[model samples]
Target chain A: GAGVSQSPSNKVTEKGKDVELRCDPISGHTALYWYRQRLGQGLEFLIYFQGNSAPDKSGLPSDRFSAERTGESVSTLTIQRTQQEDSAVYLCASSFGQGQEKLFFGSGTQLSVL
Target chain B: AQSVTQPDIHITVSEGASLELRCNYSYGATPYLFWYVQSPGQGLQLLLKYFSGDTLVQGIKGFEAEFKRSQSSFNLRKPSVHWSDAAEYFCAVGEEGGFKTIFGAGTRLFVKA
Candidate 1:
């Protein structure tokens, strides 16, 4: 891919339903990140994957929020029992490595929980 | 805890006017600072970044940022504003050896003719 790619550009889910957002990063990138952008809000860090090391889940808002990445490729963000507050844009970014190097971002998945 | 603060929620500037957006960050050690721009319905793109060396760093799209360790501030600036430059700007900071980077709330710039 020329850049990071996200699936389902948009998603509409009823409250209490589960939603999944996917991301396919650029080839050979060694780091991936997940972030949530609320309406008129900043990027909220969700999770980070670096190579084969353990993921940094410090930013997940709650137990309902979880994400997974296989190697340095595709990653998925899953939200269980989604609530109205879950409505936001989920963004995925991959970088050459960790340490806050340049990040290539995807257009993101807009999730609307009604 | 590391954090980045962008005091202005939004600002309006006339096209061709000089611009400045303020940012402040808190980190434990030497910080890596960055400015990212997001256009409508688009993903964020790096404007510039600062880690070491000169306090002033240049970035793409004619954007520049200055890292002031004394005040823990990394401010973005442009000599002239362009209507096409209207967008949301984010300031971020990463720890010296940490894996994660945190972003500021963002400052939306409005370019008026």
Candidate 2:
């Protein structure tokens, strides 16, 4: 696709259930990012992937949240044992290069934890 | 540490009127500044960004922003806002060392007819 694409545009999961979100960055772009935006809150950086190296997972809210990227292409964010507070819009973005470059974002997955 | 702040939670502007949105940041040295707009149920779209050289940067959607080093601020402006401009705007800052960028609590704009 010409732009970043994210799967499961909307997802509803029961509390304590696990969920997975996928993202496909713009073709040939090396940088991918994950962020969560709760209602009335700013975008919170959750993780970032550059190439196939180790991802920057410093922003993950807890141990239950984890992510994986394969060969600088597709990425997945997994949330284990979700809670109501986990409900938010999960956004994915990509850039041609890393480090503050122009970003292209996906429409995002609106996750609802019931 | 670097951070961003958008003081206005919401602003209402009439069509064809000028618009200004305030943004402040706390960072050592010159920071990478950016302004992004998000329509309801959509992803963020970059309006403008400031990296170096000229502090004033032009962006899409008839929007522009000036980086004021002295004030530690980068504010977004539009000469004549259209009704379609109504959306949520976010201000963000990035340091030189890392790819992690922090965003401010966004300002929601309403276009009054």
Candidate 3:
């Protein structure tokens, strides 16, 4: 892909329903990141993956939120028993490496939990 | 912990006027500074970044920023404002060798005709 691609640009579900958001990073990008942004708020880091290593989940808000990436490609974020507070734009970004490199962001998936 | 601060929540400027947006960062080491803009319903687009070397960095859309190490500020500037430049701007600081990037509450720019 020319840039980061996210699936289900918009999703609406009732509370307690589980949902999965997928992200396909740009070719050859080694670092992938997930961020959550509430309406009119700044981005909140969710997780980060560097190559095949264990993802850094330090920013995940709770146990209900989890993410996984295979190799250096596709990644999926899963929300179990979604809450109203989970409604936000989930953004996926990829970069060549972790440090000073610029991040290419996806359009993001807008999740709405009722 | 690295953090960013955008003092102004919203700013309005007339078209063709000069514009400046302030940003300050707090970090222990030399920080990786960045400016990003987000249009309505669109993802954030990088305007510019400062890693090292030159204190002044040029970016796309006629934007530029100066990295002042003494003040811990990376303020974005443009000589002339355009209607299309109205958007939410964010300031960010990335930790050294770390995956997390802390972002400040954005500043929304309004360009009046």
Name the best candidate (by DockQ).
1
| Model 1 regions lying over 4 Å from their true place | none
Which residue pairs of candidate 1 clash?
none
Over 4 Å off, model 3:
none
- Candidate 2 residue A52 Cα shift, in angstroms, is 2.5
Worst 10 residues of 1 chain B by lDDT: B93-102
- Stretches of candidate 2 exceeding 4 Å from the true structure: none
Report the C-alpha displacement of residue B48, candidate 1, in angstroms. Answer: 0.3
Cα lDDT listed for each candidate: 0.92, 0.92, 0.92
Could you report the DockQ of all the candidates, in the order they appear?
0.81, 0.75, 0.74
lDDT over C-alpha atoms for residue A7 of model 3: 94
Q: Candidate 2 on B1-113: residue-level lDDT in tens?
A: 89899999999999999999999999998899999999987789999899999999999999999999999999999999999999999999987757877899999999999
- Give the least accurate 10-residue stretch of model 2 chain B, judged by summed lDDT: B94-103
Q: Pick out the ten consecutive residues of candidate 3 chain B with the lowest summed lDDT.
A: B94-103
Every candidate's TM-score, chain A alone: 0.95, 0.96, 0.96
Per-residue lDDT tens digits for candidate 2, residues A39-70, read 99899999888886545788999999999889
